[model samples]
Every structure is written in structure tokens, then in C-alpha cells.
Target: MSDDLPTISFDEALPITAHVDQLRQALHDHQVLVVAGETGSGKTTQLPKICLLAGREHIGHTQPRRIAARSLAARIAEELGEPLGQTVGFQVRFARKHSEATRVTVMTDGILLAQIAHDRQLRRYDTLIIDEAHERSLNIDFLLGYLKQLLPRRPDLKVIITSATIDTARFAEHFDDAPVVEVSGRGYPVELWYRPVTDGDHLDAICTAITELGTRDGDILVFCSGEREIRDATDAIRAMDLRFTEVLPLYARLSAAEQHRVFTSHTGRRIVLATNVAETSLTVPGIRYVIDPGFARISRYSARTKVQRLPIEPISQASANQRAGRCGRLGPGICVRLYSEEDFTSRPEFTQPEILRTNLASVILQMADAGLGSISDFPFVEPPDTGQVTDGVRLLNELGAIHDGGRRDAVRLTQIGRRLARLPVDPRLGRMLLESDRLGCLRQVLPIVAGIAIPDVRERPAEHEAAADALHRRFWAPLGDDAEASADGSDIAALLRLWDYLRDQRRQLSGNGFRRRCRAEYLNFLRVREWQDLHSQLKQACTELGMHRNDAPADLAAIHTAVLAGLLSHIGLRDP
Candidate 1:
């Protein structure tokens, strides 16, 4: 077995060596452990294989994002001299290319949760590695809490929690004093400069800083709160006096090709304006300068309104540190913070865990699906407010996703709920997709659902907003809300038209006109691809439900209501 093992070289720094040994020993000793390391540390890529070698069995690693899972798997495979999906495989919500013989499988945390729902024991893997635990995503937190209860029952299961910069003491306490191992990162010294900001100068200040940095060597990474800011900053940067810099805007919305450009190196200076997506999961290879706007868009659950709001808030110190560390990955760098040092000192140490922030409907559904009884009793590093838990159960009950009653007080998923969970979309959109299928509007409803789930795909030229609006209206069926639009009026046609226009313009434009179109329309080409994948998945769900394609008018009202079912908390009633 040792002879068959592939040999690979890594930086032999003290921290890397120590962390590798700790991970190796953890698998050797206890069946569960948590490894805490900052971003730019090699743990994300390196630790799993160390366990694979030490234990002589396949290792399963979970990531928060599909792109990160696939990219990291490919990089690890390359280092191990194995072809993609051979020794290393990856599985996301809609895509999977793994084999029984695969030594390591890297997948999204949601996928892992789905697997656990199917197989409570996770008997297939000898070791389970949960990466990016600090993100504290709904799935990650649930997995951690669930697995803690699972460890004693399945002593054979070895679990590893890998995080960037999290409060490990809390995690250790949650795991009942699971030994905590720390690893030093490879980040270089980054000069920090806090620039004072006026009330509305967020975009201007970031652009100005990027323009100043563009004159120097290396690429620039500007962090913003969301897609809107990313687009605004990208446009502002291009409009600035940095004619020499090639501006590339990156976010979850960009098409895979566009997002990939941020990672690609260019001859001239490249400026990447992105959202929080870049902070931890992704490592842009050549970024040497970082512009942090000090704000990030966080999805919050409003108990008062019982709604989910994507409000911009000051980033936690951990996130700020992660953003700054991006600059120092390759070499010495500079991080120009948009806020004063006073703001930094006052920031929260880490982000509020996802349990506290997000509408917990899906989380409750997931917990119910996982047979984790009553989320209130589940062990969390930081238990959510009872009001939030009550809201989650109530929301799930209203959506008809869970049956709520009994002496056990257990929540169980309905048949529709199971279908909803499998749709690779928000529970609300999943309900809409299922209902649309039943209504024979899969073709029409699927694309719209995809569009709503993916907001960064509507591309338009800065000057051609009128044209983009025209195209959008072309797909906007004038028929009543209850009427189904023709296939030509569907969102698929709109996306195809936009994609065709982008391809044509890419061939014709010399300046940043193509990017300007993307920015103006709030589109990310990569997000369109993600939407397409989502559309395909919904279609598969339709087929699984035995719904056939037909020309019949879909129950548009029912589909809308189904979407509203899961999104009831997010709904805004208009004055009648």
C-alpha cells in the first residue's frame, strides 16, 4: 500500500509539519478531532491526504462551495499525479463524478448532509473531513453538532473539522474537549492602511484606492458586500484614471469563465472587485493588493417581521483579517482598509454563526430529515434564540414541508419536502419547481426559478440599459400573473440572448465595454452557468416525479404560491 501511494512535495515549514502530524495522529488515536488554521494555510488541500496515507482508506472532505470543492480536488489530484475523478473525486448538488475506488471525495457541505440523511452512519468513508468550519454555514454547523452525537455511536468514524480563523475553544468545548490543533499560515507581511471614509464614498474610495494601487506591480483584490457593490466598484474602477489596468469583476454571479479570469494572471495589472465569496473559500493566485470596504452583506432573520433581509453590515474582525490576508498569499503586500482603525477594533471577533442570521426553515427541514430531533435540543457552539427556533418550526409548518405534532414532538419531512430538498435550489424555489412540474410549466417556471436563485446573470452594457430592459420585457409575458408565458417569453431565451450578445461583443469590443455590459446589468456570467445547472437539476426532478413535457398552460398561480410558500418570510406585501 505504501509503495502504491503517490509521493508529493509540500513546503516543509514548522507549522505545516506540526499540523500534518497532528492530523495524522488524530486519525490514529481518537475517532474525532478539529483542526483550526487560518486562510493561506495548506490544511484545506494537504490534511486529508495525510489522513488517507496514515489510515490506508478513502477520505471524504466537505467544502462550502462547489467551485472550491472541484478546484481543490483537481489541484490535489494533479499534485498526486492522478487523473481527475480517479484518485480524487468531487460531488456538488447537481454534478458528481466519483468512483468506488476513489481515495478521496471532496464535496459541498450540503451534499455531505444529504448523504448523511441517506446513510446515517456514513459507513462508506473511513474518515470525514469538514473544511471551512469557521464559515459556520447552516449545513456545517448542523453536521458538526450531529456528528458529535454520532461519534460515540459509530466509534469507527473519524471526523476532522478544518477552519480558517474561528474561535476554536468554542468548537473544542462543543466537541466535548476534542483536542484542538493549530497550524500557522504561509501569509506574508501585509502593510495595513486605514483610509477615512465619508458617508457615501464607499464606491469612490475603493475605486480611488484601486487606481492608486494599479500604478504599482501585481493584481488588486477589492472586497465589497455583495454583487451590487462589486458591479458598482468595478464600474467606478474602470471609469477611474487607471487606463492601464484591466478590470475584472468577480462574484458568485459571474459566469465560471469570468470568475476564472480573476484567478488567471495577465501581463498588465489586473483589478478584481469581488464579494465576500473571495474572503475564505477562494485563493486568487497572484493578488498582491487588497481594498477592503469594511462591509459585507449578511442574510439576517428578522424575528419581528419574520423575514429574511440581506443587510449590509460591518464585517467581523475574523472576516476582515481573512480579507487582508488575501494580499499576502504570494508575497509581501498592502491592504488598504476603507474604514478607520477604530472601526476594526470595535468589530466582532468572528461572524455571527449562520444559525443566528439565516431563516432557519431549510435548516429545520434538514435537521428533521437528518433525524436530529427538535433543533432546540441539538448541541450548537452557540445555541440560537428560542424565538428563532420557534420561527423556523412555524415557517416549516406553514410551508407544509414538515408535519408538526406528536408526543415525541418530532418533525418529519413530507414527500413534497423530500422532493424540495433534492432540487438544488432554495426550498421556496424548489417548491415552485415541483409545483410547476405538476402544472406542466417546468420549461417556463424552471428558468424563472433559476433566475431568482441566481441574481448575478442579468448582463447589460452600461449604455445599453434600455436594450437590456427591452430584452427583459420581451420575456415578461404581458399576460396576467396567473397566465403562463410562452417558451419564447421564458427566462431561458433571455439568458441565451444575453449570452449570445456577450459572445458577440467579446469579439467586437476593444475597451471594457463587455465588462461594462455585465456590470450594468448586474450579471455574472458564471452565475448564469450555475443557473443553467440548476435549471437542469429541476428538470431532472420533474422527470423523477414522472411529470411529462406538455404544451398545456401551467397553473402559474399555484407555482407562484408554492414559491411564496417557502419565501413567505421574505415576502413584502404591497399596500392595497
Candidate 2:
């Protein structure tokens, strides 16, 4: 090893190590290399070290979720025998932990996309690893397409795309038939037992499966579609009254302190109920049995209806396989699928790329701001439907983000669009901000926009739905109740009331007291804090852009007008 090279060690137990030399040689041979490693292949944690060994410095790696980036950074730094934020660090929204000495910086793919707006050439990184590309998120697809265009300009930059065995060929083909290195998993045999739900209740099926696996000697991992399902599953399993077992819930909305329970060592076996966030984005340890319900909340945007919806849909075969692979990590394991094998075989080979199903308005804004040509002409790995592209452009036009050039193919960003692109919120919310600036009510709109951009701060636990609802109603401004307080029957009024209440509470109460009060009020303290953080971030972005909030008293009418500018499409006429 050269004296300047960082001394790094790899766990021989991990299957990815077997192909280290091949990966190194491929890096030397090509600008882009695709690695098709299954879940538990240890590719996520070890790939950065391989890049370092290949003589690449200052690597930028992206994970789909903030938790994954932070956890993986900690794990990699520990493996390198250094403290976190020293050799390996991570940056997520509102959180950063990197120093001047950091060589490997892991961040969410969205963070990388945001960086592209400022650092067009990505001069900070010599090697970029797009991890879990098979997820095919909007940010990932945009990055893939952008990198494809950027590779020729920056021949010195090396790119590595890591994904499971699913759709690796398409990724390779996207990069001009880049060489692919396949790494086998840990080789633990995972037995799949199909347990289709005959009772029409998945919770019952999950409980029955848990009862059947009661004899099993390892921790159980149940895959639910969302937080609501997780909560229901946790209650269902608890109702079973299994002894010596702890039930835990995992999801993206969870606070860091709550998420830590899954990683910490405990005495009894645990039943971890989680969303698809666990499928590939996060890897929970000590999972020897997986109960997959074969359903997840998939985001889809309807161009005709102009609505964005998250519906519970069947998981593709690739996602099912990823869930099953989670258990085989520790040892020989079993996966009890709550759907028929024939159903699995009949499902799609892969989930639809988010680019195809999602609203492309934000994406179009991003591309336009990057000076990329029309959305139709951008080199997406899988080109989106032309109608969807038109809808995106139309939405941008509606928001005054883009203006048509004399030529039909020429799509240009307006000043409003450039400002919208600079703010990290949705284009609709960004439009609301701009309108607020015009209405002289940015102070009132900033928090509402940030609140809409995040998961709701009010949490209704399954067990205390009524209590939560009643407490939440305290913030509601009903019709004819208070002339000054009501926001013309707009839900934004409720949000403002809640924000005001929280702000008042925060001022008077200590940190711990505020958190306790939030809990008593059935509000997610972390989410409330996140709301505040985002508001602060938006405030700072506005300041930098020279947009100022008003000092006048709150005006519900002007606020409603400002909010309506962004939601014109959502308004409907009622027939009398």
C-alpha cells in the first residue's frame, strides 16, 4: 500500500469482498461501473472503501433516505477505525456532519441534486456512487441522466451505480453498456412459505404468521405498507400477548431516539414492523424471519386528473425479493409471504420508475434551471410518457416558472421559476412563497408552506384516535366561530393556529417541557421541530434571495389569495 493511501479493512464475511479486485480493475477500466449485489451483500457499506483503494479521493455517495446515509456513514467510519465526521461523514436536510479531513461523504440523493444547482460540474467529488439505483426514485433518475450527460465533459470523474440484481442491465445500458460486476449474497438459504390471506384481513394474516413462527429462535421483521399499518400490526401482535417479545415500529417519520431502538441490543426477541423503507433503503440487523404482506404505498401522479396520490399497491417481484433477502443476513431464515406464489410470479418484474409515475413539474423546473433542454429531450434512463411531460411543462407554466420560447421545443425558466428552483420546497409551495412576497404576507405563509412540505406534525396514534382528534380540534377555526380567526374555511387556518400555539408553548416551556406537551397533545415532537427547522431554512433562503416577510398584522384574505395562486388546479366548482 502507498504511504498516502488510507489503511482500510474489509470484513471477509461480507460477500462483496470476494470481488474487490474485479471492482478495482473495472474502476481502472471504465468511467462508470454497475454493481448488481443483492440485499445483505454488504455493498452499501463497503463500496466507498473500494473506491478509496482504487485511488479515488473525496467520494460522494448517495442513499435514498437520511437515516440510511447517517447510519451507513457511522458504520463505514467505524470499519475504517476512525470517528464519524472524520474520514466518513453524512449530510441530510438540516443536518451535516463533515469536516475538512472527511474523504467519504454520504448524503441523500436529493442533497446531491440540490448541490448540482450550485456546483454544476460537481467538482467536489472524484468518485460518485449512486446507491440503490433500482429504487429508481425521481432524484436517482435525474442524477443518472444528468451524470450520463456530464461524463463526457468530466472524463476524470468516476461513477459507480449500485443496485440489487433487478434491472441492472438497464442501468448498464444507460451508461453506454458499462461493465457490470455481480456480487453474490451471503449464501444463506432463505425458505419462502406462501401464506395467502383467506380472511381478507392482512393484520390477521400477520398475526397468524407470527403465531406459526412462534417456535422460531430469531427476531421477526414484518413489512407493512406505511406507518398506519405498522401501528396496527404492532397492536395486533401485542394483542397476541406473546411473552419475552418486544414489538417495535420503524419508519421515516420516526424520531432519531425512537429509531435507535431497532439498532440497539435488547434481551428478548423483537418483532419489527416497518414500511418499505426497510426493504432496500434501510437494513435492520438480527432479522431471521420476514413476514412480507406484499403491499407498499406507491406514489403515482395522474396527468389527466392532475392529482398526486399515494395508494397501497402490490409490490413488484424485485421488491418482494429484496424484502425476503433481509432475513438471510444473519443465518438460514424463513420468509412468510402473505400472498400466493402465483401472484408474485404474475406481478411486474420491477416497480415503475418514479419519473414515469410522478408529477414531473419539479423535475422540469430542475432541468430547466440546470439549462438542460426540454423534458422530452432529456436522456432519462427510461423516458417518461410524452403526455406526462406535457403536463409537467403545463404545471410549470401555470406556476409562472417557465415561459414558452418562439420555438415549441425551447423551454425556458422565468425569473419566478429560477427563484422557485432555488427554494427547496415543491413548485406549488414555492409559488405560494412568491405570491406571499407579492401580498406582503411571507411571514404568515412561510410556516404554512413548510408544514405542507413535511409529514403532518399532529400524530393520531391508533389507540388514541379519538383523544388526538379532540385535541386537534382545539386548533380548528370553525365557521362563524371567530370572524378574525377563521381563514375563510381554509385548512391553512388550522395550521397557522397550531403553529402559533406551538410557538407560544416553545417560548414559555423548557425544551423537555415542550416535548412533553407535544406528546400530551398528540403531536410528533420531532416533526414539529422539523417544521420549525424547515421554516428557518426557508426564511434563510428568502433572506439570501432578498425576499422579506411583512411586519403588518396577519391578513387571512391575502393569505388565502397567496395560497390559491399555487393551488388553482385544486379548486372545484360546487353545483347547487
Candidate 3:
């Protein structure tokens, strides 16, 4: 007879070897465990195995980003020697994998947060592992707060907070002094050296350093602030005659296929010019050196503008440390800072949590719908700015989430607001969705609203930019290049028309055939599938809200009216 439980066959040894037993015992004894370790200290990969061995048959592990969650799940599933969607699975927005017999599941934090609204007890699993908690993303903060409240009610559940070793005290303190199991003495030593330039010519300084370091034996990683810097740096490196060196870029806006190049194993020296996405979310292979300019684009809520602003600022001490750790992943490495050590030390110790730096309108709506009182009194790990919270409420009111009762104290989700909160969209888009039904244009506007929320599905390869633009222009017949279909000349009609064409094309073929069709047309097949899924979900949500009724097909005028009705506040005038 064969044993049913899966096991990991080791080729060599992993870093978690020395610490697995302690982690197992800790999980067995405590309801909450904070696992702290450096990058490649094996916390992300090893903790799940320890939990399984400690007898957690079902686990829900959360990651900060969708790609990280999917990749981690695949890695773990392979190690377990099971089919990808059988014993282990992953769920992100518009994608899900799992079976009734699955033992472990990996999902993005947003997926878990949405689950909390339906399953407050989180009855799906006995264990919950929230990875990368130190990043303090908005979803991470909300999940931490949600679990903190749900723990007492369901005392049997296990919660583990994991991050690269930076600060665990705050996380521990937040959970009634949860015991922390530290995994140390694993990561390779990385030497840190600082180089500063008073001249603002970063492009010249970076190229010069890389040219000098070309004689080095290992690959390099350069951290930049944004896309423009990445482009400039990449162009500068390619212009050099450094033999057998390849430069690649990584940022959020890149296509999935384009981003995969950064992780590809190279025969020659590889230098990755990247944004902060490479800082902690991913581990690019063979990076033996790091070049940090000590800056990142950080989002901060501006009370004056009543919106979140992305400004390039100096990296925090913790972020700088994380960037340095990227080099020492495989062996002893070197990290060169483009900023002075004194300047690095002067930055903040850790980044402010997302709760304090983001627009809170969505969370505010969720809290009100969940019966958590005024945003002023919600239990946040880090309190948001009061003025910003006030601004969020005012915005929600504008979207009709709050009653227009003229009384300050009387605030709650209206009937329309309840329906708005049901779908996973911003209140403004939600308003547009709900208003479409009344405007007699729900069917016509549904795909357009969903398409607006995602990145474009069309791929424009740089080598063939003009050709790609021409290919995209093929779909611009009805909307034209000017894309005017109504009085305001909104591009939404174009989006809807594109979605309509794709929908008809999809219905004419099988899954593989449709994918082949998209490739032939130079479109991102995956994103098109995601758009279809979003449309289905929104349609079902509307049906649940009792807003789905067979009405006359709406014309372009009504569709424009619906969009404008929801966006009246955003219209602005410029002086002539």
C-alpha cells in the first residue's frame, strides 16, 4: 500500500534545516507566530512544510502580490510532488486553482481580505500565513487587523506573520506578545560600500560605475526609482562596449512575458535595472552585486490635494538593508550605494504603513458595511490621517455610499451603495456600473467598465512599435484614433467595442483556438481572459443585487449619460 501524504525529496539541503523543529513546536504551542528571517533564509518556502509536518493539513498562505503568490504556490507544489492544482493551489483576482482534496492553498492578500467579508471565521483552513508583512501594503495591514479581531472569536486558528529580518517587535506587540522564532546564521555575508555624487548626473555616474565593474566576475542589480530612470539606465548600459554583458528592466507596468526575462538564467554577465518591485517581492537569480541610489517612488496621501501622490524620495534604512540583502542570496557578495552612508542613516528606520499613506475610501466603505463604526474609530495597526479619512468619507458620499441626509452623524451604505460594495471596484466605477441599469445600458456598459480597470491587453513590442500601433489601429475603426463616439468623445465606447469583438471571436473557437487567435492578432490572451472573467463576475454581482432586468438595448447616448452621471464631479474646466 502506498502512503497518501506527499513528501519533499531533497537533492541537497535547504537553509530551513536547522530551524524546522523549533518552528513546528512554536506553531503547535502558539495561536500566533512571527517568523523572522533574511532573504533566502528559507522562511517563505520552509514555513509551509513545517506547518504541514506539524499537522496542518489545510493552510491558506497569503502573498503581497499575485505573481509572487502564483510562483510560490508552484514552487511549493513541485516540492510536494503533487500536481499543481491538486494538493496545492493558488487564487488571485480573476484566477483560481484548487480542489476539494487540496491540502494547501496560496492566495494574494486581496483574495483573503475579500474572503473575510464572507467568511469572518475563515473556516476554510486551520492555519493562516501572511508573508511579507514588513512591506505594510494596504491589503497586508487590513488582513492583519481583520485577523487580530477574528482570532479571539475563533481561538483554534493559527496565524503566522513572516518577513525578512528587519523589525518584528511591532508585529509581535500587536498580537499580545506572540512568540517570535528567529532563523539566523543562514544568509551569505554581503559587504556594503557607499559612493555618493554631488552632481545630479545619475545617468553618467551609473554608466561609469558599471563600466568599471564590468571586469568583475558576477552579475549586478541596479535599483532605480521609476520607469524613466530604468529606460535611461538601460540605454546607457547598452551604449557601452562592455563585452558579454546584458541589461534588462523590471517594473510593474511590464507585460508578464517581459518581466520573465529578469529571472532568466544567463550565460553572460546580467545586470537588472529595476524599480522597487525587485526590492523584496521577487528574488532575481545570480545577482552578486547591488547598486542602490538610495531612493524609491513612495505614495503618500496629501491632505491638501485630497489624493495620494507618488513622489521620489530617499529609501528608508530598512529598504536599503533589504536591497543590500538581494546580492548575498547565493554567496558572499558586494553592495555599492550611490548615496553617502550619512545620507542613508538619516532616512527613516522603516517605511510608514500603507494605512497611513493611501486613500482610505474603499476601506472606509468596507468598515461601514461590516458594522465597524465611523472611520475615526476603526482599529488600524497604524492610524490613518484623520483629515484624509474625512476626505475619503466625503468622496464616498459623492459616490453615494453615504446617505445624503444632511446630518453629519447619519452615514451608512445606501441601497445603491450596498450594491456598489458588492463588486470589487472603486466607488466611482461602482457608481457607473449601478447607474448603467437605470440608464438602460447595463449590457452595453458592463464590459467597458471592467475593461477600464485593467491594463491594456494589446502588446506593443519595442522592435515593432509602429507595427504594433498599426495592429492596434485595426480595432479603432468604430471609435477612430480620436475615439469619439459621443458628445464628450469618451473612449469607453472603443473599449466596449474591442471587448465585443473579442467576445464574438472567443465564442467562435475553442480555448486553445482562441489563445492562438489572440497570438496571431498580437494581443495579450491572458489579459483578455481576465477581462471576460471580470465581466462575468460583475454581471453575477448585479444579478444578486436585484439590478438585473431585461430592458431595451441602450444606444450610445444613454451609455454616455450613465458614465457622465457617475463622473460629474471629476469634470474640470481650464481658463482660455
Candidate 4:
């Protein structure tokens, strides 16, 4: 232990604080311990410190989201009175902040999985904490399964699984019935009001609820289904011109500066419209009221079609309760559900694990790349269906990622698979990059592949949809001697053209100027930044793999060929 360690103080009011000795001992006596702490229990920030105090050297804490990872690392570092990246640091996609002196590393679960390639044994950390395990995301389930296999080999390693109060026993039982320490939340009373939406319009209901709550004491947290809902509700609420209330939006894709504003002090009351990201991954401060619309866009994959679908559906009962609990942290609070109690009771008890719901191709490819044995043998908390596993393997084979081993389940990474595994992209996008390399059009295809990874950068404001579309049409590739112009009516061509235009503008303008240009052109500035960041990361990965850019000019046919390699299954025949 360092002699100059900052004097640490625990907030006695936190429920998790009371379990310090018990948690520390649990860690000491057991190789794996499960912690079930509700929202506001301080478990997310405090558990890592407990690991450090238990004499654990380096700690690796995994969060389900990048925002949560970054925010939690900052909070923990602040609490330690140490500069960020010194005592506590975070690593998310395309962003890393950590130094040699750092003892705790907070990272998205995907980042940790990526580390499995370089650190197969995860030997750098003496302890690993998987936070938000109750979310049951695909990555968390895979990490849990991976750790289950790894624990026996690395007996000295300590694993702490933390989740909300829901379904903690299953996690404990998964780890051979590891001891579970349940901690209560802030003991504040929250009155639930079931105001079922008589009409299907959530915006009207949210606006009506806001009108009712505006006269109250503290900030209001409204849970919208997704970003569009947040934007729509923000507009609707602002239209009402509520007196002295600040309307804000919170979601995963918002810029760091925008997200910081939600936490900053504000006058009067603040109305925050957010996605499920706020449900458990983040805690917006000073929320004395909650508005639950009872719906969220849940990602479900159709193995038959091999398409990932994000459809707005009623939230599970566990999720609904989690959203309601957000308000109770600050004294007495009220939660007005936009749905009736009968509707809430009709929903599922808990959410289906993402492993069961999402495409398993990426997970299978990663496992094959790491030589983690067959996916079938992997010890997930709930193993995916056999057909889904088979479909995943088949997709890899179609992408030339797996060798023709004459076995449906046998997974052996081919040369192409090896390169695909090196890049931190979806297997489909990885295949496109490989195809681009072979077609000598990596430069043209790089942006398109990266663009496909994120939401479209083009923005069409509701009020200016026509103008936005007209301005957006400026990027369409010209057809010889034709008055009508399009990207040959291909989405890939449009992406390339927009990417080229943005790159040119970026070269001519300052950073702020480029952002202004994006706004003027109705492009999603944050999404553009995300596209650039992901592209840069992919480029760096390609360079490291000795795949240099081709100096050839733009090749339309070659670009389409490269793209086609990734979308063979997506092609359909149109009947005239």
C-alpha cells in the first residue's frame, strides 16, 4: 500500500457502507462474491474501493455502458481526492484514461472482452468487478461465462458480481452458489400513482404529468422509451412554457458536455426526459419525482432473418420498479406511471437476458478467436438456444470467418477471421474491411463500414424535413447528363459521398466551424463525431494489422463488391 494514499471517508448514510467489513471479508474468504444492491446504494462506486481496502492490488470494474464506465470512474476518482487517471481511470470505446499509478480501471464490458485477446488470463488485475449484472446484457453474460471458466485456472483472482436486487440468486447459483450480500437502498418512501394512458399518445400524457408536477418541490425525471421520444417530449414540455423549469434530455449518445449539464446545479425545477440508460446505469441527482411511460426500445434479433430489431415494447416489471426507485433517493417522492397497475402486473417479471435475445455471431467469433472452446460448453448464466448458436456459427462461416471444419459447432478462425477479430467491429463490418483490402478499395469502404456501425449521421428535423432532405441531396453522386441526382440510389454510395464531403469540410474549417457546418446542413453532429472516432479507431487497428490504405482513386464497383461481401444475406430480389 502507498504511504501517501488519500485519507478515504465512507458516507455512513449509504446502505453499502454498512457492509464494508462483511464485503471485504467475503472477498477475502471467497474467490467469487455476488452483491445485490438496489439503485442509490452506493455499490457501483464503493465496491471498487472495498476491493482496494481488502488489499487487492489492481481492480478491473466492468459496466454495461460507456457513459456509466466513464462517469463512475470520475466519481470514484473524485471521492478519492485524486486526479482522474491517477487513482481511478476508465477505458471506453475510442477513449482511454489511465496511468501507471492507477489502481482501479472502469471500462465497458466490451472493452474488457477485447482485452481478452491481449490478456488472455486477465492477469493485470487481482480483482474483477462486473457491475450491473442484472441488466443481463450479452456482454455481461459472456463475461460471466468466461470468468466461470477462468476462475478455476486462476485461483488467486477475485471476482465480484454486482447487480440490482432482482435475480441475484441466479447469479450466485451460477457461480456455484457464491455468498450474496444484499444491501437496501435509501429508505425513502415513494408513492406510486398509476395514471394509465387512456389514449396511446405518451407525449400528451407526459405533458399532462409535467403540468401536474411543475408546481411541486424538486426535479422531475421522466423515462421516455428512446432518444426520439426524449426529443419529442422535450419539445412538447417546452411548448407548455412551464414556469422556471429547465427541460433536459439524457441518453447514451448525448455529448459529454450535454450530459454534464444534467448533473449541474440549476434554478427552480429541472425536467429530465431520458431513455432506459437512466433506469439503472446512471443516477441523475436531486430527482424527487419520476414519470414512467412504461415502455422502452428493446433489441431483439431474429435468427431466421439475421436482423437486429429494436422495437419499443412495454418494460418488464423489474425495469418499471427500477425506474420508480430513481425518485425515492431524495426524501419522499412520487412515481406516476403512464400505465395502469394492471398493465404493469401483466408484464414479465424480469427482462430476458440479451444473450438470449441478440445475435450470437460476435460472441462466437470472439470465443473462437480466443480459443475459448465451443460456445456450447461456455458456462453462461443462461445459455443461448442451440438454433441461435448454430445460426451464429453459420453466419461466421458465410463471412469466411470460420474454416470448413465439416462440423456445425466446431469454430476455427480462418485467416480472414483472424483479421476480423483484430478489429473492434461487428463481424459483418470486419468482413467488409477484409473485402475492401482484397479489392484494393479499403479507403473508400472504411468510412461506409464505420458509418454502418453507428446510427446515420444525417438529421431531419421534424419542422425542416423537406429542407434537410434537399440540403442532404447535395452529397448524392451525379449521374452523367441527368438532372436527377442520387448516390446511384444506394445507401452505401450516399455514406461515402457524405463522408468525403465531411472530411473535406473538416480539412478546411476549425473543429467548431465544422460542427456549425454540420448543424447548418442538418447532420447529427454527435453522430458525426462518433462516426469519425470509430473510423479512426478502425483505421488504427487496420494499420496495426499491416493493412495499409490503398492509394487508388474511388472505385464504385469495387466499393459495392466490398460492401456486398458483408451483406450477402441482406440481398433480396425485387419483382417488377
Q: Evaluated with TM-score, which candidate comes out highest?
A: 4
Candidate 1 error regions (>4 Å): 13-15, 199-201, 239-244, 253-261, 264-266, 385-391, 404-408, 419-576
lDDT by residue for model 4 (1-576), tens? 466566667889899999999998899999999999888999998998888887887999999888788788988898998888997999997789999888899999988988887888999988999999999887788789999999999999999999999888899899999999987765588999988988455778988887776588999999976565577578888888888889999887778778878878888889998888889998899999999989876766655545544455789999998998998897999999999899999999999887777668877877777666778888888877887677778788888888886244578888988888777676777888889988899988999987876667788889999999988876566523242734467778878888988888989996558767988898876567657766776788898788868996867899999988988888789999
At residue 442, give the lDDT of candidate 4. Answer: 94
Q: How many angstroms is residue 36 displaced in model 2 relative to the true structure, after the best TM-score fit?
A: 0.8
- For 218-307, candidate 2 gives per-residue lDDT tens digits of 999999876656765787789889899999999866776788789888887899998888898778988999999998867676545454
Ranking by TM-score: 4, 2, 1, 3
lDDT on C-alpha atoms for all candidate structures: 0.71, 0.84, 0.76, 0.83
| C-alpha TM-scores of all predictions | 0.74, 0.75, 0.70, 0.76
In terms of lDDT, model 3 sits at: 0.76
Question: Which sections of candidate 2 miss by over 4 Å?
Answer: 1-6, 198-201, 235-241, 369-373, 403-576
Error of 4 at 32 (Å): 0.9
Backbone clash pairs for candidate 4 read none
Clash count for each candidate, listed in order shown: 12, 0, 0, 0
In candidate 1, how many Å is residue 152 off?
Answer: 1.7
The list of candidate 3 runs beyond 4 A from truth reads 9-14, 197-201, 227-232, 252-261, 366-377, 385-391, 405-411, 414-576
TM-score of 2: 0.75
What is the Å distance of residue 31 in model 2 from its true position?
1.2
